[model samples]
Target: WADGAVGPEVAAAYSARRVRLLDALAGRGVAAYGRSGMNVWVPVPDETGAVARLLQHGWAVAPGARFRLDSPPAVRITVSPLTEADIEPLADAVAAAVRPSPARSYR
Candidate 1:
């Protein structure tokens, strides 16, 4: 392994951080898959908007459409390499992402 040692404690800390983020997203109507490990694949109602919102808050995620055709709007959030401090901001951004914006009236 090129990346140094990863013990149980390190792994557990990351898992806890991921779970917090996942729970935060769940409150926003976003669902995360990957029952095991640190795989964070969230199926958002608006992949484009979700990604944009996350990006606006200094977070990055993989768009589902980039990997598959006929796929729903989704984004991938990898929590392994990220720091635990990221959970709050990421959660806040994710929660804000699901909010409906003002309606636009077409003339």
Candidate 2:
């Protein structure tokens, strides 16, 4: 669905193909469709067609939820320069502060 160029003809073709696919699915008793952001960013043309096709096929759009957690701010203490003793404590403190959490861990 990544259309490099956007034009009337491309839009029409995309709409037609989407309808055809939906119709085929309907014939098989598949009334629901779930589309996620598989691509890093959805192209504008593809997004338009997707939304139109979903509504045309009687699908309802639902709002997605956002979940975020607030964490305590880190203490910043600037020094002119640091020796090995200063480096070890700072590194240890950072490692402890960055322990894995559900909201902050790399997936």
Candidate 3:
């Protein structure tokens, strides 16, 4: 499909979607790493919690632990099925999952 059904237009669309996802996450101050492809690696405080929280928001993401045990907690989010409209909401959910609350508050 890479050279046949998936032509330049298709590839470009995928790239755009990937970039949009990355930009959205970055805009929220979330450190996501994704130079290419549809998958984005977003580091979080807890991979399990982030995955669960994202699932609660109707997003099914894979925990980084499934791929690497030595790395810090993170979640893998794919932008394959995500449209331009879905980018912001997904970013918001990711941000919320990554930073649930302030580490400390002084009153």
Candidate 4:
């Protein structure tokens, strides 16, 4: 962008990927707060637990607490390095990590 190295097509691709991640997460009933840029913020009940769970799925996300904000617990996920194929799996992992599971009943 600075040296005209980043063209419109490249920037468009980045924007597209970000939107894909946001849409995927929304489809899974996960709320994400990001309209532009490469990072999406997802609010979770427990930031630490969410981070740990996502890590277990091979995805590293930044805990909102790291930002020192007084807002609710959330995680920051960067979508820049993720490919188009990675969106669904990432969204699934995020949804699983952030949303509480229903109690299982053994019959």
Candidate 5:
């Protein structure tokens, strides 16, 4: 919020959408790290692959490699500024793109 704070209704909508996205991702077996309120970091087997897959489904996520070479393969999913109705679809796309392999903690 560059201009102080948002109106009550806008704030409520953002909060509700964030919750919806978090719930949907959790339901599909996605474990997210970092701040759950904003940019969520989810480590995967291949960040590049996941981003490509998500892009095909209409959602675009940034790979960790884009910012750092030391970080493990991860995707940054934005929860805020998202639509309530699109939450489930994005979650489904994530599930399809990132599958938990053996020896992984994502379950």
Candidate 6:
């Protein structure tokens, strides 16, 4: 889940985008769910109410699950499906959004 204090308008926009993506997945008969920082079970068949409920708590559903290292309870990571097409565009967008700086550089 994405956690940030984005304005309602922005949040709604993100929500709408996610819903549309999920709807497309649903149409394809593909099940998807988002794993968030918070420990909560989100079911398939994503809907507005479910999305809103998650957002209210500062969580955004991605397309995966959260896993923890057996040896370290504190070590946890969220895994999501990624395709080659998604990687380049997503990286480019992130690069474009980040403010370039001498101290904190990203490519």
Q: How well is each residue in 1-107 modelled by candidate 6, as lDDT tens digits?
A: 24565566655544554444444444544443433222222233333444444345443433222442332111111213333344333323222222233475679
lDDT of 4 by residue, 1-107 (tens): 44667777776777888889999999999999877667899999999999999999999999998865579889999887899889999999999999876789999
Residues 5-87, model 1: lDDT tens digits:
77777777667767877887777666676554565777777888988988888888888787667867778777887776777
Residue clash pairs of candidate 3? none
What TM-score fits each model? 0.71, 0.27, 0.83, 0.83, 0.72, 0.32
Give a tens-digit lDDT track for model 3, residues 10-93. Answer: 667778988898888889999998786668899888888888888999999999988776888888888878888899999999
lDDT of each: 0.74, 0.33, 0.85, 0.89, 0.76, 0.35
Model 3 per-residue lDDT at 73:
82
Better of 3 and 5 by lDDT: 3
What lDDT is reached at residue 14 by model 3?
A: 73
Candidate number with the higher TM-score (1 or 3): 3
- Please report how far candidate 3 places residue 105 from its true position, in Å: 13
> By lDDT, who's the top model here?
4
Where model 5 places Cα greater than 4 Å from the true spot, the runs are 1-12, 34-37, 67-70, 100-107
Please provide, for model 5 over 1-107, each residue's C-alpha lDDT reduced to its tens digit, 9 standing for 90 to 100.
44647666665665676667767888988976643245667788998789888899888899887756687788988677577678888889888889854575756
Candidate 3: stretches off by over 4 Å: 1-6, 101-107
lDDT of 3 at 60: 92
Q: For model 4, give the 10-residue run with minimal summed lDDT.
A: 1-10
Worst 10 residues of 3 by lDDT: 1-10
